[model samples]
Target: MANYKETAKEVVKLTGGKGNITNAWHCVTRLRFNLKDKNIPDLEKIKKVPGVMGAQFSGDQFQVIIGNTVVDVFEEVEELLGGTGTGEASSNEKEGIISKLMDGISGVFTPIIPALAGTGLLKGFLALAVLTGILDTTSGLYQILNNLSDSVFYFMPFFLAVSSARKFKTSEYLALAVAGTMMYPTFLDIAKTAFMDPSVVNMTIFEVIPIPYVNYSNSVIPIIFSVILLKHVHKWVRSWMPKSLSLMFTPMITLVIVIPVALTVLGPIGSYAGEYVGKGMTWLFDTIGPLGGVVLGATFPLLVMTGMHYSLVPIAFSNRAVLGYENMIGPVNGCTNIAQAGAAFGVAVRTKNKEMRQVAISSGISALLGITEPAMYGVNVKLKRPFYYSLAGGAIAAGAAIFFNCRSFGGGGMPGLMSLPAYVHVEDSMNVVWMAVCLAIAFFSTFILTITLGFQEDAAEEVIAEAAEKKAIKNGTKHRVFAPISGKLQLLSSVNDNTFASELVGKGIAIQPDNGEVVAPISGVVSVLPDTQHAIGIVGDDGVEILVHIGIDTVKLNGEHFDFKVNKGDHIEKGQLLGTFDFEGIIAAGLDPITMVVVTNSSDFVEIMNANDEGIIFKEEELLIVL
Candidate 1:
């Protein structure tokens, strides 16, 4: 995690420093910059930044792809920018309307997606509860659960307003006020009455202008369009009004002028636009039927690649708002995700490179859970054939889903196997079941296709060494890490702490020490030996930065029940004494005694392989190989 912060610093420096960036934002997998001088930063140098997966100038923006840790990096960059003397970045480079629209949509939607996805999953679980007969819908707990899930969709306008306001550079509180008006009880109560009563008609404001009963709940486009207008209006009002009056009267006048227009004109325009788009999609699918799904399904990966997939987000939201469910972009997108996951899984099984296999398997799991960027970029796109096979798999899966009446009734933003429960329809209980069948079809079809249709593999998995172990650590000489003091060897993923388990610190093995004894795993200088005596770091002759930590959160013990023989900068030999800790004391202190040995500079190597020690391991045994 700290490595990504350093990555942020490197990225900020590489991208013409803090001053060069005018506007910056992030999507799921990338940090996008609107630079004052886009040409100043070299793409190659940007790509070489430690945490960056890739870098490119996409259309009118400079994009630095950073998987998973993009948010953390974005925050760090923001903090760095704030610490210095700065002004807003201004850019003169012109962009097309389409590019600008895409940027706007991405900026506005990116911040709110996590909320949507989280609540969406909750909604899915609630559906499962209903289906399993575990809870009656009429029960108090179910009632609370239903509204808890509904809150986000019902207040979507507020979320959109905050994000859109920031994108448009307007007052946040005023934007909230506008959202408040849209969801006001006065209007919502009337709209509900109109739905039930036959004689109710459109209400006239000042007995002159008629305002349509547009349900603001679950609405998106209206608030976005409204905020765009608000940006201009706020500026205009501030320019004309007294600066002293601006603190109060300006908002009053702005709301007075904007709310009426929103209800009477802009609201209806956005409302109709969303309705027509929903209707248009319905018509297209109905006329050509399953063929329409085939085209969209096959092209979903390309959409993800070019970052144009976000363009479909609003349409999907709109469809859910207007038509109560969307057949496109939700369940169909999940099928494609499953297909991509399957393709990555196939690559994982086929590739001889351990590193590539690790990446493929992890990315494939992420795809199955609903995020596909890692799988798509790290594995399938690189292999080429897996990507193509995925398209076919997605097409067939989507066609099957549509044919079986699977649709996204919940409108969850993250689509995958986990979200299949969102397809459940009370009137048609088979909806989720059909979607599961389709996703399974996606996985098996693409997996089989990839294996049967093989592609060219990487040139080599193991690095070829030129020289011997006496040379510099950079040389690709075979390196071994012996057991420091082992009991049962466990994968790092099993560690309770995220900092270690996520491999944010580094990658290696965790061990449950049979006794208190600790020894050096490698012959090297003791690079870091903390006073707390819970951890030690060594730099191996093979250029591996090794760290051995005793137990989880043992640092909080403040040197309790610990002793060490080594000091920082002391030269240590392989299997030599380093330290000892009371594992029984640590356990009694309510802490985990799982010791860890990690290669801190793992990315510097071609591959790191385990020496195959599983259970009840002894001391001074070969544990890991570094190449």
Candidate 2:
């Protein structure tokens, strides 16, 4: 793999040297860039770079789809981009109803990926062992593995507590405290007693009067509902308590108020709400029956793209808990994932671009492993055609699933091949049949569609070239100047931070400028100007691209203190007025607008040298080097 630092530097050079990259992190795969500027970076070159698979923009963040080695690459990228890290900001805000709903669902579910994958793998292995007769249910090994697999489900509240705390920006310990209340030994004991003897108990101790006990372990809604209420409880308690005793008294009172409300109302209500939602979904499937599968299959790809599919997890789990079986969503989702893999395989078969072909093949494999983000974001979303093919295949699989009356025997989200054993109930022997049919439809339909569509080799090139050209232009300019706010001018190379000094993936000079209005360093054609108004990209007379990224991932500021002076594609000259900005207002709004003068097209340059020192720089001072 190419050095991650080198690749990151190239990216920064491509971005015109000025991007406020506040934070960087990675998941099992993918290096997520939370850039200050909202402009889409050079995703194409980032993909072409040796270590990267592909790059994509999603959910107000930039995701670089790297495979298993993403962790290693992330370390290198961090080293190159300085080590400063920031917490991921919530994507939720005032938006359209559907958008907000989607954001909430994504936020709630993303943190659970590790648990789901780990448990799924264990379950898959257990099934393999049983099928092979290597282990029997009566064996000690079976007991051990069963416990391992079941622990994730039993202690799900703990997992959800941590994830929900991050999502809600609340104390993780506080969330754990709330989760503990629900899963406390006393609570479970009371629940067990209540189940055995209905009339004996008074109100539960947490409440004024004895109430019926409900088991909260392995439950989803109660904890989430409780945490949501806890946010308000915490906020209200903190406001009134004396400073000295605030910490201790606040949590005590918050719990005193919130816990009872949770047990008395929210817990039961949320549980029923989940149950009803699941039933409603099942009812829709029943009414539609086989046709429902086909409809869902067709739309599943789009739903995944928009991240709406996560909302179905709670419904699936709830149905499985309540009915000991789940119908509809899981089967459809499995089919969708299979269809995605099939489509990617098709691309691999048809495409000649070595890079696209490799990505297609690897992405297909990853999808089969149950991580579809790489395939869905990198290959399917980019190609557009494969996504449609997956939709068609999904519909076919859905039809098969519904025809077979497939039902899940265990609780979970999507049932893959590994979890198939748990889903097989003797009464619903049709599940096996449906599984076969779904697999067949998903695989065959996508395979055939991809062959029919063939690979559009030309399309990939068009996109790739456009992306590369943008990078080249951004990096090619000589002597690019920047406005230093009447303060010390830090050489672009002297910023010491890995992201700036090493030029990993973004470009521009860092300055401790005197606070004032930021103007265009060297005017050119504006390439990108986002709605957030936090940054602008300009292409100069020399075919060099310069991006003036105004602030550090301040897109979240919602355009509060920014004013744009140029439209995309507008032409201007040196020292031209770009726009007026509120440095103090942005800071007051809790944002950092660090202006960077970057050369987006750096590939054409033989060498780059920095000229300005720790002094005030006029608008046209010789600040950068180009050969």
Give the worst 10-residue stretch by lDDT in candidate 1.
459-468
Pick by lDDT: which candidate is best? 1
Q: Which stretches of candidate 1 lie over 4 Å from their true place?
A: 83-89, 196-199, 460-627
**Model 1 accuracy (lDDT, Cα):** 0.82
Across residues 268-330, which tens digit of lDDT does each residue of candidate 2 receive? 788778778878887888887889889888887676554566667788777766775666777
* Weakest 10 consecutive residues of candidate 2 by summed lDDT: 84-93
Q: Which candidate has the highest TM-score of all?
A: 1
Task: Give the backbone clash total of model 1.
Answer: 1
Model 1 quality (TM-score): 0.72
Q: 1-627 in candidate 1: lDDT tens per residue?
A: 358779988888988887887767787678877777776776766777887878877666678888877888888888877732244446666778988887788878887887887778788788888888987899999999888888888899999999898777787888998999999988888887877885788999989899988778888889998898888888899999998778888888888889999999998798789888888887888888888778889998888777788888888888888777878778789999999999999998888788889999999998998888788888898777899999999999988877775778774657897887788766778888888999999999999998888766543223211112333656466888998996999988888987788786677888998899998899877766655888988877555778999999899999998999877656678989887889999999999999998998787777878787467777889888888
Q: List the candidates' TM-scores in order.
A: 0.72, 0.65
Steric overlap count per candidate? 1, 45
In order, candidate lDDTs are 0.82, 0.68
